[model samples]
Target: MYIINFIVSIIAIIIGINIRRNKRNYLIIGYNKLDEKERQLYNEGKPLTTASNIFIISGILLIIGGILAMRSPVPNYLTIVSWGVFILFIFGGTLYINAEYR
Candidate 1:
């Protein structure tokens, strides 16, 4: 279970990295001409790229927690709860940002 959680955390980190990379690519690579609204959203999303940092940081913490759990036995329930908290935090932040910003 801990291994699975650790893998999930790694995936989360990868996702964050991908999003950050995509944002950079979008700016540097330059895409086809977008409508005004699309262009505005792209500009706005530039700021939102920082929002993905929440995922990256939380994922790192989860990875550390998983390692700790492995080295020094912790309660399984506690591990689950910790993982849930991070997931909830990421989801809630993403939703809030989307709702309020977009």
Candidate 2:
């Protein structure tokens, strides 16, 4: 079960990385053609285009979290860090999804 959790967490990290990559790609492409509303959002830094940044950061956090959660000989503090990373991963995902749908 513990191994499974670790694997799942790693998978989440990979997904996050992909998301972040897509967002960056869109950003680099100048966002194609932005609607007026999208332009407004971009001006306000809300840029509802892609969740790449969030995903990338979340993926990194998950990697740390997974390392901590693994049954390795790491210290207690690492375990805490792992949990923290997992939390960030969740937050990133939530924020991305919310922004995308909204």
Candidate 3:
């Protein structure tokens, strides 16, 4: 269990770093693809704002959960955190699909 937690923590850290590094690019691509009014609204904070917020929140939670799992017997928390990340992934995919189609 400890080893499992350690592996999960390392994976989470790597994932977090990669996602954070690319976030600006993601924002740029998403922003540029929007119409002027949509871009303005995104800049002002609306639906698009949630994307980064959710990603960051889920990433942080995953890291924390991974750490906690590594430190204790409660490794199941990492599973929950992983599920949250999965949900965010789905949400992001849906957003991309909607944007691409419309």
Candidate 4:
């Protein structure tokens, strides 16, 4: 369970790095669907940077939470909650970014 968290965290961090480097806009949902004009209306840099930061931060939080959960005496619910919150945060953040950029 904790191992799964670590693995997902690593993948998220890698994706964040790629997004920050502007090498993987296609990985962004709905990014590739925009035509050139719509793309122009959408400011690319700020939203991508923000989303990347969100991903990186969430990934770090997952790692830290996983470690804490492993060391704590609590059951696996802590990890489950952490993962749930992470997913919601990512989803909400992505929606916010898309709406704001659009």
Top candidate, metric lDDT: 4
Whole-model lDDT for model 3 versus the true structure? Answer: 0.53
Per-residue lDDT tens digits for candidate 2, residues 17-75, read 66444544343224456666765555333432235555455556655655555656764
State the lDDT at 12 in candidate 3. Answer: 46
Candidate 1 local Cα displacement, residue 55, angstroms: 1.9
Worst 10 residues of 3 by lDDT: 43-52
**What is candidate 2's local distance difference test score?**
0.53
* Residue clash pairs of candidate 1: none
- The global Cα lDDT (0 to 1) of model 1 is 0.67
* Candidate 4: Cα lDDT at 75: 41
The TM-scores of all predictions, comma-separated, are: 0.69, 0.40, 0.40, 0.90
Residue 21, model 1: Cα distance from true site in angstroms: 1.1
Off by over 4 Å in 2: 1-5, 20-40, 43-50, 68-81, 89-102
User: What's the lDDT for all of these models?
Assistant: 0.67, 0.53, 0.53, 0.86
Tens-digit lDDT track for model 3 on 1-102? 445544554564454455455554344345466777765545433333444444555555556656666666666766566666656764775576446534
Q: How far is candidate 2 from the true structure (C-alpha RMSD, Å)?
A: 7.0
Q: In model 3, what lDDT does residue 55 have?
A: 51
* Clashing pairs in model 3, backbone N/Cα/C closer than 3 A: none
Tell me which of candidates 1 and 3 scores higher on TM-score.
1
Better structure of 1 and 2 per lDDT: 1
- Report the backbone clash tally of model 1: 0
